[model samples]
Target: MTSPFDFDRELAELGAAHLLRRRRQVAPLVPPMDLQPDQEHLRGTTYLIDGQERLSFGSNDYLGLSQHPAVIAAAQQAAARYGVGATASPLVCGHSPAHESLEHELAALVGLPRALYFYAGYAANVGIVPALVGKGDAIFSDALNHACLIDGARLSRADIYVLPHRDLAALEAQLQASEAPRKLVITDAVFSMDGTVADVPALLALCERHDAWLLIDDAHGFGVLGAQGEGTLAHFGIVGQGGVAPEWQGRLGRLVYMATLGKAAGVSGAFVAGEPAVIEWIMQKARTYMFATGAPPMVAEALRAAVQLILAEPWRRQHLQALQRQLREGLQAAGVPWDLWPSDTAIQPLVIGRNESALKVMAALDRQGVWVPAIRPPTVPKGSARLRISLSAAHTGEHVARLVEALRQAA
Candidate 1:
């Protein structure tokens, strides 16, 4: 029963290159016997990693809705009414009123006509791309697109042209030269690892000119961007008018909007929003949608509460901005040589360069009871390994300062 594949040696090679990823078990800090006033908020940003309490700069709970009492209560109530599991695929009787409501709210939140909910963001992309374009079609993706988009393009059987990151001119050049009958341009509304945002308005314009569909995965942008956390579209003053914005209104048909509920919304699923006809087509044809079991009703309900919080409370985003400024300023004052990317968003990347160096810095912080992970190659390009410091509204100013000091000490 000996396997032909040299798995051991292959793994050893990966380890040697410091490219092997290890998962650290992490969980909330159970409140102390003598608890503080805002223990729930403290719990969300602090974690017990490997039996030690640590300040976490690795979470995507950007607005801290994950710990909100309302969100948790909504899930509990829904569970009592509808039970825990969804039992079957959406096409086979798993879809519920909760799912429908979340979808509708999602559509309205993004200023699109309709929305289709998916159990996961990855499923949304892989399913949507293939449903939109196939063999004779072309997909022009950003060179720095998330893996889901890349996988989706591959699944579509389309000719994929990866344009240089943020290079609208190059994207336009390809669109102009392409002869494919159907074309799709896919990008992340916010580049995840680098913390940089896509110029979505420009990308949308290009897609419009080329007579193509623009699918933006706003996983990092949703619940974090915009004046009301309406997302990246609103961030650019282009989307979210309930279809009344004159300049971008006519072009809404060409835009396929998608965002995750997990990061900023503090829930566990994703949804695709667009024109009714287009979403209908995707819902009908996306294999991931057709076959996967629906997310539990509890999740849908919890997301509803999360959405309300995102709109009702503006302080989360404001505090997040303050934290961003604080971290950047602190790092600058410390004079760290590595570049802190020019990102005003919550995801801040400190490029450490080289796998060993990145891990070294990460380990140094771990020793200081800080839990910011080191990101290495394939996640980011080779030689650009970094510490992707994810800031959350749950994080305090003190926490940011502690991280800055830890990083400084490590440096």
Candidate 2:
């Protein structure tokens, strides 16, 4: 007879392995009694966990635009004007002026001919991959790519080769060996867990030599990298104020770029920008975009305001970089046992190696009123569990200093 399902036993095994996960209920900052009434109205950077306020270092609100007055106001206005939901799929009656305008703005921001919006970053990857290639095609992906990209490659029914993380030689070899009719190279512009950026220009070169399509998921780089916040492409000097480099400008047709709004943009939803024809193809064939109810029009409006803020305020990115530098330098000075993964970005990961050790450090930090989440497998490779410290522009220097001191005491 077939064995009966045993969730209890499986859960017990996971617990014994120290890989089980739990969620904590958290409330955004509540003002202290000593603060004035006007100051009380201002949101703080701490979170209340288990009835204790803790300084948060585990959020992905990199630019801290999530609580911006303009973004919130725009959302309110759109909700009043358009209501709460789209109520239909994009292909049906769901498309709105807000969505269209956001799409146009995103394409321009990313220096692409057209763009297609999705409900989330995961949806964009899962949907776009299959829409582009399948069956006889081949997909070259990075070993440490986001789960969504891995899932997308699997779902495509294509020949999948996962190259070692950031190994350009391996990637090139795979690309060269593939004889499939359509070849696509997909990678994250920033590896989320390790917090290191990919060499996009080099990847583009390989793709060009191999005559393969290059898709870069710049979710982490979008609002934080470029001078004008144009994302990884701009950071590489491939595209700038004038436009894409002349030599590579014509190759834009084969390049696909995606960025999610929830991270740096401080909103929800994601967009894929590329050649007009590629977007048109995705619109018709991407099932996730076709079958799912469209994202709320209000969200699209809020995202438009977010894009404007990203472009208008360069100081947000500057302040964020300063905070990152402060945290890194402070940690080094404190001589903490755990070293952060080499990353100049806002995502500074302190690898704790073993799962139990990571959990212990996380708990210790919690006791000291610092909230940094312990990230474990299968989010990262086994034996490399870490404390993922996601810095935000809103974080003060004093906050960073406090966290450093907390680390010293906790250690």
Candidate 3:
């Protein structure tokens, strides 16, 4: 009998290209191991995924608030007070006192007049883009932006220009040549893949020259960077002042900031903060905002507590920074090639040119009880397969040392 499918050769070619995907299960009773159906064992960094113990370095819970007693307690209390679900879309009665209260707290934290929440970071990006720009508008984006940002720009129906990474000159040229009715420059404050920061001040200057609005998605930077953890804008000390870019001074009000709570905040959901008119416009126009259910009240409560912990417990950030410094310094001292180790942030990438090499390294580390994952194209550029090493506050210096030792042994 003839097969129904005809792409066997092409499929095999893809496998040969190291682009195939698969999964494994975590055994019951293994701490932090990911338990998936139909598998005996797999690696994981969190102990309670399906309820097990595993040493985790793969999670984005940079501040380690995911299991923080206070944060968990807050979530429990909120669920007890508000119930298991919000019941309906925020526009249709899901917006509760919990949501409102979190919004106020987040607004104050970011030094903005208002903030609007979304169920996920991707939804927030998609909603914000379409709400702000349309058929006659334009968006200048960084080339290595997160997938959500790329998708959001595509959904916006605006003329989108992807500028070279951190190339202000090229961006200015694009802005100079464009005559779209509205202009928006969007970027991830920290590139998730490479862990590099965006040049916000330079972008702000370029925006002023062309009367464009700037949107900084601080998904990775939000709860880990800046004084008081306000994010990249504050990290660079450019948010509150009005004189750095005189042409953009008062116009700084047009700088829109959006961030996810799932990373350093160790919670779920995202929000956007900006001028009253812009937010009001989104409330009235963004489909995700108007149609989707609000973030769960309990998640908001957890995030509120997470934010407080980030601010009150500055040691978490300090610890994370120190860990990064130690890891970088130790790796350098050990003669690990710097060219292979890119990223100053906790999201260190141990570049392995071949996907199989990266996966092999990951397997070797996993056998030693570490859990960094192999990232390959198309998630990254071709020939850039890497072990994406993410650090968390929950980890100790000893943990970092162990990973470094494992890398040395693997090498």
Model 2: how far residue 15 lies from native, Å = 0.8
Tens-place lDDT digits, model 1, residues 265-310: 9889899998899999999999999998989999999999999999
The weakest ten consecutive residues by lDDT in model 2 span 33-42
Cα lDDT, model 3, residue 79 = 95
Query: Model 2, range 1-411, lDDT digits (tens) per residue?
Result: 534687888888999999998878877765333345554322436778778888888878898887777888899999999999999999999999999999999988877889999999999999999999999999999999998899998999999998899999999888888899999999999889888999998988888899999888998999999988889999888887666878677877788999999999988989999888999999999889999999999999999999999999999899989988998899999998996889988889999899999999999999998999999999999989999999888788888998999888878
- Backbone steric clashes in candidate 3, count: 12
**Residue 328, candidate 1: C-alpha displacement in angstroms:** 0.5
Residue 62 in model 3: shift from native, Å? 0.5
RMSD in order of candidates: 1.8, 2.2, 5.0
What local lDDT score does residue 126 receive in model 2, on the 0 to 100 scale? Answer: 97
List runs of model 2 lying over 4 Å from the truth.
1-4, 31-44
Better-scoring candidate (lDDT), 2 or 3: 2
Q: Write the per-residue lDDT of candidate 3 for residues 1-411, one digit (tens) a residue.
A: 647685787778778987887764433243222335532222223443223345556778888777676887899999999987888888899998988988898887876778988889998898899988998899999988888889889999899899899889999999999999899999999988789999888888888878999998999998888767777777787653232233334666768889999998988999999888988898888888888777779988988899899889889888889999988887887776424456767687778888888888887777776767788988898998888889988778877898888888777
Task: Sort the predicted structures by lDDT, highest score first.
Answer: 1, 2, 3
